[model samples]
Target chain A: MFFRVVLGMVLAVASCGAMAALQIEITGGINQGQAIAVLPFEQPAEVKVDVAAVVDADLMRSGKFSPLPRSGMPTGMAKDEELLKADAEVAVTGRVYKEGGAYQVEYRIVALKGADRGKLLGHFKGAAPLDLMRQAAHRVSDRVYETLTGQKGCFRTRIAYILRRDGAPFPYQLMTADYDGYNETAVLKSTQPLMTPSWSPDGRRLVYVSFEGRRPAIFVHDIFTRQRTRLASYPGLNSSPSWSPDGSKIAMTLSKDGQPDIYYYDLGSKQLVRVTQNQAIDTEPTWSADSRSLYFTSERGGKAQIYRHDFATGKNERVTYQGKMNLSARSIPGSNAIIVITQQNGYRVARMDVDGSIYMLTTSSLDESPSVAPNGSMVIYATVYNGRKGLAIVSADGRFKANLPSSSGEISSPTWGPALDK
Target chain B: MMLMAVAAAMSIAGCSTTSGSGAGAEGYDGQGVVTGIDSDGAMTVGDPNEVQTYNGPESLREKNTIYFNFDSDQILDAYVGTMQSHAQFLRNNPDAKIVIEGHTDERGTPEYNIALGERRARSVARYMQNLGVDVGQLSIVSYGEEKPADPTHSEAAWSKNRRAVINY
Candidate 1:
């Protein structure tokens, strides 16, 4: 049994001219988000991007905070008491000004109407060049979000996905962009298809499947260096590469010996170790947060279900029973809960708890490839919207939803990059 | 009507193998080029020279793509004759090569679909090998649900999308 929340306004920002980047449109309403006000940042006219708006969008997209509209906000530097009068539990105030060749940003999160009332929860200052002003704004949002929600913000992270233009000479492109679908860049392009991009634990490299040679092969590409190395090009399939949390090994699916099975390729030893020995199809390997086990999709029981392979015991156990088909089980960071694609009315994105309880996260029919954010607050997946293939994001609790559709063509196989070191 | 056409094509194929000049078969121009049949049973030839020497019946050549039921890779009894025709063609032309590309409907996870596609392609390949087609002449690749024959989201489209293509 699941409760459907009221859908929110569809904020469709029309693309200017031929902009091909994905545009984020918040499409679900906030069910239980805390009310907060992000005041307009006082900045000079030379600053092009609205720093406070970026922060406001970041917090709002997380589905944990509902930022008050700027028109209703009290004018200029409202105190905690004034914010409380405006029915805001917290207020974020900031200012941006030119400091030499860089832009200086200073922001504060003030608590209202609590034991810590009229107190500064957090105050942070940072500077970045004009081009990176948006990232600096996201940092402010990160601090404010963590201070209020007790969870790290994923706004500063990146996501890699495959974009297929219908009739281009090189249609398939592996692209990465900011968490909010900004700063899009193609890391690799090919005439053949690309699939299942898994980020490295250090967020430097991506392991993905490509069909450039007319057969499926896995390749590890360094994001910063633009260097690509063929990781697994066996005779059969070499797909579904997942970096372990410890950054020591990558769990993948290889079919060189026989049917598709799980294998771990150690980075230090450069040796491949088989994990599953079943005759059924075993693919889409995802590592647990502790790196103690791997959760992968297997068809041993006549239907695709999630199975866990423990390293210590060397045993494989079935992990899901609620759905007739449950595939692509990705463990939520820092928890045992997993985001899986389950067949209900249609294929949907759901979160399965340790106790085997399923909480539906998406209501769409063809939702697949659910990738959890680093903080486990949101999930990004590919789905069909308005009869076209596009990517969507939903809150982990299913309270908020948004669409990140490309300006042209289709996008799929989205993998959220790991939180990188600053 | 379809069964009658298939029967007529089969007899013509029997004549072509025995008489060696069945160029008068429907959809064959007698110039070593075989026309392709679309979903609507219409024959089309993109370029006569691109098609290789297909000594099989025109119906068998038209049956290069075989459909499957949802989530199942078992070759249907309906396509057995088509598989036999292709296998015989391969056995006759030992140097000929073919790629078995598998696909699925856009329903489950893409990675799982990839595996499912591979299983379907392997099923077709195994069937051909059992029918005396050389294993070295066949290669397999799975496009999963990435490439669909029909991009629509209905059952009709899905039935068409869940298929394995035998590319000669």
Candidate 2:
């Protein structure tokens, strides 16, 4: 079932690019997207990949832009008259040139209003080899997105996920890749189950559960150094390690006290601070943007629902009422709303404001592990497609939805890494 | 009936699939695959692929596993005899040490499932202790939603997955 779908999508993606990046199948989006034109980038023969097309696709897939086809674009440069005729409101023209064996790309965006020659809105420049076409294109796309939307773009961020293959030596493999699922590299492989990967604030380390010791144990792994340090493995379960906002502590669920409850592991002191003393299950801890409160899933109210615990007051209150069961609530960076996997029509992902306004984001029956991008533009979650677990992405507003399916095995605990600054 | 109501309540919330019970695989009884022989005369039960020996008592394998309802850890009345027999086997073998692995169907959050699975295993351990089984002979671990008896998403598969198996 998995391979058949992959083959079908591969044939459909043959038109997109040479290598098969994440074959995104957008299920839902706005009817009338914004009009933008990305002109063909002038590049030397050394640059094999098309940078302009990548930028165009990124904008188009965002469910925000309807990029005009290159054939319909003007001959040399789009004038206001030509763009207006083509129904394009904005235009992106760029050139990729080599200098001293390194490549340099510069883009100029024009706002085509009423005038004959459109006024240049902004100029963005990037330097990399022709081999780094994807990164260059992402840079251009980020600039274009910021200029149009007045918000930071997360095109350069990385996402870490777990791939579990049944017969593979390392059945559970931790992998990291670009936000679009390209350039995926396996960071660690283990014979035991690996899950709940949470990225540190700096994006250099990930703390997750590795069952290598014949039991659940939390391990903090540095991405670049390939070094791992055991964080928590006290008597029972040492799972659900979520990094705090300041990277000083990790809030996790431990059953060392005979029942699973929330605890914070201070990185400096290496001491566990008990957060919740309730008899009910208190797990899946995520810190607020300010790090003053934690939003976690609890069964204290009979069934699973999201709850907020303020550290200063030592008071926790149930936050979600619409869903009978709500779990895996992740705070959107710099936002008041949290993206949670709520029980609606079979565990769909939804964004809920602190005031309790809910906006459903997915159409799948089984969706879990929602991680928002650093810019709070998109939420990536794991969903069951054809009974095989895979990752699906939805825009923050629930307008755009796309599937990021792997070739094989189940995908889980997708942690969107911090934004890589330019 | 209360367990069924709770399972139904879980389904009505649009949370997950139907709740089920009992093993659904063909030729696979409650007897788990024999992973290896123990220091004692008992055998270690684990994944079928890791099964090394078939020389152990078939009755021990058959009575070692107890299934549960979805999201509920209540051991069914049908498994009472099995649990009693296992408790007797432990009492008869003083040197035997058994690891009770708790598991859950892939319906809820992984963290919660771990807690739920642990509760189920603890319930079993407590039950055996009441039946005069030595508490020192029993060790508990939970695979949560990690290891599934049946990987499919249907209720039949889930019913089998939500279980606690005693491995020597």
Candidate 3:
């Protein structure tokens, strides 16, 4: 009942800022999701970030929970009876307060009905500077989501993407932001183009393709230190740099030898090992969870398709045969499924199981560059929105969908970073 | 006089546009001269026997960019004369270095588009090499769909975007 009403008000109010942050627009979700109430956190006028709203949006984006609107929420700290009356299965209440020139946020997830009625499921408190209030709020969401869903929440994780602002001094920017599209910071800016950013497993650095000198070169950039090391600047096209799961090597597509083929650069030894020997276009190499094999898109099969290259056996096998073209395959964490851009009706994001069954996730025609969340619960991709390119998110089940439209220029090649250490 | 007559006949044959496949040596009329305007009304003609010297970008008649079909990297027959003109210019002036920049329409994955763009550029570079352009004069880069000649999302714009630009 709450979700039915909330569906009418799906678009969240856009927050005002100097740099317009990505506004979350929930398009669809499953109707059977657990109904939860996230009350507005009690905070002083000086504190700007809404901790409860962030948590609510995070849960809603997960597609496992339907957050009740504030209109349905009872006034002033709803009790268990009030929550039950509002059809909320669970209630998240929180407060943000200042302490010693810093901001601290405290939140509690309370069960409303069932055997665990009136029981506190989770209580989390985090502190950060005023500027990092959104991050602190995301941590609260992470804890609350994990406690409720029994799975690690990706709210605390960040997303790395390329934002191209035409005519700017540095048109292309490597950006990092909270999963909710807040706290966007440019990690690297370039006059030429930057694309295909792959996050290191440690979430501290990013390996991406930058055309800084009017040529495609792979660079490993430390997100915090702002130090850049050119990994591959081979003669021809050098692009599609994917960090291995173990963080020891980076698999990329290089044309120095001949056509674009998969090659892994060992960070420790600085040796480039060829993965696929095909003359066809072999690119977009994504390491498996174990880092023992690579899942890459190759045209060796006559058309672009997903292929698994086992490093130990030196064997290559085609993984996808259903789509007209399947490109940019990324292994989903904790599962045998991989998210990729498949061309069926048009280029759309889809999840392919180990058995080779394809499940379309997004309905957009021009969707590309699908990056699965660390938890594999959602996918972020680049798509055309109203003729302008922007990023979007969809639940792995294709139930929930949200559009993250930037305030200005186009955004593409989004890669969700790994979960940060607690 | 015999070589000039043969070159003029080849340029006349290149103007036929009947061969839709990859153009062979007959498709290219060398000597930095592009004769006979194509259907696009975008070609320039110079004396086939003049032994045209490479002056600058103006010498190539501004025919540096070549487009491809959807999801294709094959050099169209229409662009063969343009490639021949560029090849002649590069061979005449080995000191002139050019960057063959590849691109694609805003479809498919960005990484794949990068590969496709490179394929387009490589196709152009190979075409020039076949026409005897020095390898040292050509370097290739792919912008994929990032730098579009036209940013519009329609088929016309994508045709313009799916191109390989010869930047001298």
* Candidate No. with top TM-score: 1
lDDT of each: 0.78, 0.75, 0.77
Q: What is the TM-score of chain B in candidate 3?
A: 0.65
Clashes of each: 1, 0, 0
Please give, for residues B2-48, the per-residue lDDT of candidate 1 as tens digits: 11111111122111111112222334323322333322222222222
Write model 1 residue lDDT over A45-133, tens digit each, in one string: 76677777888778877889877777666544556666666567888887887778777888778877679777898888888787778
lDDT of 3 by residue, A114-146 (tens): 898889887777787777777777787778778
Residue A358, candidate 3: how far off, in angstroms? 0.4
DockQ of 1: 0.14
Candidate 1 lDDT: 0.78
Tell me the native contact fraction for each prediction. 0.28, 0.18, 0.40
Q: Please give the lDDT score at residue A235 for candidate 2.
A: 83
Ranking by lDDT: 1, 3, 2
Encode model 2's per-residue lDDT on B66-167: one tens digit a residue: 999988989899899988888888899877777788999887677778888898999999999999998898888888888887877787998899999887
**Model 3 root-mean-square deviation:** 12.4
- Candidate 3 stretches with Cα past 4 Å from truth are A1-21, A97-104, A125-129, B1-55
**Candidate with the greatest lDDT versus the true structure:** 1
The candidates, ranked best first by TM-score, are 1, 2, 3
